[model samples]
Target: MWLMWIYRILILNHEISMASIEPIILGLEGTAHTAGVAVIKGREVIVNESATYFPPQGGIHPREAAIFLAKEFPILIDKVFKRLPFKIDKIDGIAFSQGPGLGPCLRTTATVARAISLRLNIPLLGVNHCIAHVELGRTVTPVDDPLVLYVSGGNTQLITFLNGRYRVLGETLDIAIGNALDTLGREMNLPHPGGPHIEKQAQSGNKLLTLPYTIKGMSFSFSGMVTAAKKLLHDHSIPDVCYSFQEYTFAILAEATERALSCTKKPSVLLTGGVAANAHLQTIIQKVAQEQDTSFQAVPRNLAGDNGVMIAFAGTHLFNTGKILSVEDSQVKPRWRTDQVQVGWIE
Candidate 1:
């Protein structure tokens, strides 16, 4: 009781005080091909809007995506303000995804966030993109001390909390699973963002072709498997190859997640990232969690993707916890790791 009181009185952080007294926050996210804006009041998202760049031909070109974000952000910001019930002056703070993403995308989002923070003179917070995803799962679900499986186009890792840090217990050594799938799709001459297309094909495939399964210690490797699948694409049916590819890849992640759970013994397993939208991977992770006698969680399909809501949600927490940044310090970090964040709100 005394400690709690002392913490409340002794903690002298302007941002944390503002968060506790004020209830509204504006958040921005453009860590990759998506540019978004969100308004968070207390724990609920009052406004969540995003514009994604989908290249008609190949994968996302960084420069093109940056240009697209530059064009679309104004429209998205306008949409949020025009639709909001309250005035813009009601917002208490501003937040943006600061790092662990593509350089151009991160810069575009950060620049806007900085401009807004200065214009409004509100407290500014730079959020971690990976940490934002985990925060989204927490906002929409009931999970505490969860072991997280974060998979996306640029990242793949099994993470959990211990000793005041979100630790990376296992990760991909080379390309992330999402990128590997996209690359495979490119190799097969399929469209960009091949995850959905691959999922569709894998459903019809009954055959499971033999592919290399690489798991080092608790980490995952998909580069070799992708190469081998490219070779077999000549003889095997596309559906069958896609099926085996998913099975192998998803199983590897499931196994690594299971190991993380066993090591940490956390009661919950939260599956997130763009790939969490996959039905097969969800089933596999759910099964692993159930078999381990642990709880399972997945963000709703809408919240499963990258958006400003997660970044905004994380911003709210960080502000309350006294993590405010100056405009000069609020630069983008394309290679920031999740484990480096000091999680002050989570207990």
Candidate 2:
């Protein structure tokens, strides 16, 4: 009887200690080309690990990408737990990128996340991928309630927190800007991943080639611009085409983002996602945001791309606001829309 009472007292004290400690969340990111794992306690990310796979040629094959993610995710899982840096297990939740991504990759990631959640018997959260990018920017920067510009390989949009959701004021009607850039890189046969090469070669560009620029209201189209730029290869130099391509695309995106700023009446502008890391695009958006008298925030280079940190950070907020998902309800949302998710995390 004495030993049992002692054990009960110790267990109760341990629970009280955990209650005094800030909660933590482990996030799984398997949205597209990257498979990542992150651990965050409160607002700080203590572990952010990821592995990326870029195809040797052409666009990403969904099944192949999914296979690669499946292989790498287990490795990442091992590394994350091995390097936790602490013994505290206050892992209050498990969050995963639940939608708006390649179907195969999304499913693969969700499967792993569900296994972890079930094994731990904790609440799970299904987070929107694009919204994760935006939240990560806000978390790592000094901006609050900014007009968010998210540009990644699979997405492009201008969003802001308004009313009760992340409102999309503008977006790509055709191809995402990052996709367009990578496609142009492929056409030139410069490299498998062409974004940086395009930027480097564009530095020597002395002239701008005339390219198609399509915009309808707040939405823009990059397919026509990419096609037009590709056609210029025979007539114009690669450097010139690349320069003009960046110029035209950046201009249109800047225009749309500018429109969102005015309409949203936001106090700051934050840029995030993989394509937001481009030096040229950063320059363009920074100038635009400053011109409008709104502060601009660029997510740190490391956190800008698709990573698990964003998922965990966003998930923590959602979990605190009473969001929970059962095992059966934790399915992947391959085409989940950002605006469709009820934003209970942010005020």
Candidate 3:
């Protein structure tokens, strides 16, 4: 009788293992100045899409973008869903950015996601915007804990993990790195979103115009450097300024990374966000890591820019931890911090 019971128990376990696995959640990322969506099955992203909007004149036009997102999101969501092998209803829950982005854009995304949850009678999970950005990239990048320098139009500076959360070890005291680059690029008559343009120009030129590289304690400042670059450009060639600007900015970034590494006593580093796409920055980071014999990880170009896949992966992690969101929970936050999040979330 005892032997027969053991056989039955083993057979039941086999049957359970054979049952189909369903996706844990659907992730929506609208925190980007550009909008995006990603579907995740556990920790793996299945479909991710982003629509980048270039301002007609200068800077992001909030009303224009809100209208754009409202019009474009449904189509993009449909496209992503169609690519999925299974039905959306099969998803265990829905996740959307809760805060830390353009208010109008955030509301538009939240409204749509909430409507989906209400219509489908499914639960929803709200995510912190900036936390999602860093976490999503970190999940895929190999860099463990040395430091994360996130430079973009809206944000810049140093990040480190501590007490089970990512903390802002240091950051820009003024304008973000991407903004400075773009502003300088504009002065050079380069196109909008000019970080790439500056980098391209620098490849053909040598550093002629010098710029300041500042690191005050754990934080750094970019306004002075931006001012100096603009002044120098009138007397110097554009390419030369571009080369020197890249060198100066990257040097400050590398110095901050090294400082963070030493302070935290960690040996791994990760580069993320839009600015991480710069080849020059990558070279500098790799060089510094090598000097310290530290490990470095950078997100691939596809994942570097803001996209939905990171949201999906983040949602997947949160879902498995029982942090699921309900329909009543659908809300947007314009300022959410990464370190405020509690760990022990899903794997």
Q: For candidate 3, lDDT tens digit of each residue in 215-287?
A: 8987888889988999998788888889888888889888888877778767777788789888889989988
Candidate 2 lDDT over 119-206, as tens digits, reads 8787898889999998888878989999999998899998888889998888999889888998999999987567778888889997
Candidate-wise lDDT, in order: 0.88, 0.87, 0.77
Query: Which parts of model 3 are misplaced by more than 4 Å?
Result: 1-22
Judging by lDDT, tell me the better candidate of 1 and 3. 1
TM-score of each: 0.93, 0.93, 0.90
Please identify model 1 stretches exceeding 4 Å from their true place.
1-22
- Between candidates 2 and 3, the one scoring higher on lDDT is 2
What tens-digit string does per-residue lDDT give for candidate 1 at 1-347?
99998777767576666548656888898888888899988778899999888898888898899899999988999999999998898887888999988899888888888888888788899899999988888888899779999888878988888888788999999999999999999888888899889999999999999999999979988999999999989999999999999999998998888888888889999998888898889999999999899999988788777888888888888888878999878878899998889888877
TM-score of 3: 0.90
Q: Per model, how many backbone clashes are there?
A: 0, 0, 5
